[model samples]
Target: MRDASSGNALSDTMEVNDETQAPGASWLPRGDDWVLQLSGAWRGQRAALPELPAQDFNGAVAVDAEALRSWDAGLAAQLWQQLDPLARRSVTLDLQGLPQGLQEVLALALHDAPPTEEAAVGPAHGPLERLGERTKTWWADHRKTLTFVGEVLLSMGRWVRGKSDMRTSDLMWQIEQTGPRSLPIVSLVCFLVGLIVAYMGAAQLQRFGAQNFIADLVTVGVVREVAALLVGIVLAGRVGAAFAAQIGSMRANEEVDALTTLGVNPFDFLVLPRVLALLIVGPMLTAFGAAVGMAVGWLVAVGIYGVTPLEYVYASVESLTLPHVVVGLIKGTVYAVLVALAGCLQGMAAGRSAQAVGDATTASVVQAIVWIVVAASVLTVVFQRLDF
Candidate 1:
């Protein structure tokens, strides 16, 4: 007979003996049991056994492999194919005649197989559930941020007590990064801003024949606000992003974890130097920016507004008081702290991926800029209200 599955003759490899028959299997009904009989060399050529016909039998099905000469996983696989049909008819298998090794192999294959689609049922989530999950995640993030801030503060306290593990060289290097290297950009931005202010003030004042006041406008604006604000924004984009990318890469490479494993506080070893450097550099940059801005204003007033060089210098100097410079420096110091904290916090929290480092760098710059604006607004209001 032709095997329905492979369209091959079932007796192709069968050999008949004078007193016994060649290898094959036969199914027979015996009362409440189904007996499957096997015989001969059930290997190699016999591996491509025909699929079993679907049956509607009840009770137990027993395999009889005693007369079999040899077998392999192929035979085991063929036998396994018969199991599901028996299971569908509520029949239990009697695998007593199967070799222990074959039985174990079959058992393992069945055990590791993925669950059927019917077994993967799950409940669906509602919109409220998703919203609650998001809220919880946000709260957790805020809590972690506050904890990081507290750790940084504690590190600073330890440094003040002369018990910090931070290296002086690291502090110096960070100061160089945030200070001298940044002067050109700071000076350029301040000078352009001063020129713009002088041009605008001269335009309005010239209409009223008071163009000489352009010096006062540029001086007061630069000393009290514009120069410091411009420097803060520049550093936020430059130093803050650098800090975030550097620390985020270290986090990704597990170097920060290594420091922790070695009993070194990352807040002290990594964060303190950055914060202290920015704090020291912020005022210095602000002062330099103010000077450059005043020089630019002098140029505008002398060259464009028909004011004498000495008179422009005197008006610029007279327009700025110590209190105005002090306020600018204070704003710079606060802006520096905000920028450093934003970068460091985002860096330490970065995930272990290239994309995450980039994201943290972007976030650091954005957060630093936002905090600087907010700080400047609040400080401006307070300084004005106090009549400074």
Candidate 2:
């Protein structure tokens, strides 16, 4: 930098705050170079400082702050705003004349400043890229679920060998919760479903003077499909959500970690009993729901539709086959397993927070319902193909 004392005054100093002399800058000629003179207090937004000289900086430039009494970031900002463009234009800058602190601030600002132009945007993802990302996410989620299922299976093996931590009392409590405690809602729903089916069937059958056949329709439908589906749906909403919330809350409180520390298999102690309880109760509930639905259908047919009670009973008896009952119970078992798996998987993988427990509970219900529907469809298709 050219010495500020050796520079020749080129123009009168531009006074920004003449009354207070808040801060100002001036231009001077130094042979083939230029000198910027700064003076007065330049702290914060105390007062406006002089605008940068309009003259072009086509040679080496030096900032001279010998008269700068005190300053702050405000001064640094002004210098950057004014001198950054000149530096980009290849003007040799010598800021040594400024205070060391100000020089450092200016150096950092100039080094990290964003480009004057707008940044270019990245390209949009193609269909293949989006598909790949979705596939990866799907695999990640299912991998966790599969791992949980494997753990459950191993726990089941230990259970069979009488080496599991599953408690008989726990299993019985779960059975009470999943079976008897659930009967009221299951009965109400199935009865209403039966009433609807019977009414719909009677409406059409009455047209043909064949209202007696309403028993056949309701019996076959309820026993083979509706009862199991309604029971599964009820269990998914009630039992599945409960399992998730219980386990997830345990996880949030670090009880699951405590179990691991104590050498207890969490899957055995927490999950297997619940799963076994559901397995034992699932078919029983399906049968109960079927009976409730069939009874309600008989009431609708006999009392509302004026069909002969004896004929309705006879038709229902004729339509109720062992194969249909077996298929419905099998479906119930599968749905029960799926609901338990979904709930336990989400709970075990949940984050350690109340919100995560809530999310796991919600996800368990949703996943159970989805799996039940898919399983129902697949089972129906396979049974049809096999003539079962």
Top-lDDT structure, candidate number: 2
Question: lDDT for every model?
Answer: 0.81, 0.84
| lDDT (Cα, tens digit) per residue for candidate 2, span 1-388 | 4556334332224333442456767878887788888877777655554554544544687899888878987778778877776654445679999999988988765653322211111111577765665666568678888888899999999999999998899999999888999999999999999899888988999999998889889998999999999999999999999999999999889999999999999999999988998999999999999999899999999998898889999999999999999998999889888898888888887766666789789989999999999999999999999999
What is the TM-score of candidate 1? Answer: 0.67
Which is the leading candidate under TM-score?
2
Q: Which regions of candidate 2 deviate over 4 angstroms? A: 1-124
In candidate 1, what are the lDDT values of residues 136-240, reduced to their tens digit? 656876798899889999999999999998999999999999999999899889888888988888889999999779888888888889888999999999999
N/CA/C clash count, model 1: 0
- The per-residue C-alpha lDDT of model 2 at residue 15 equals 38
User: What ranges in model 1 sit over 4 Å off?
Assistant: 1-138
Give each model a TM-score: 0.67, 0.69
Worst window of 10 by summed lDDT in candidate 1: 115-124
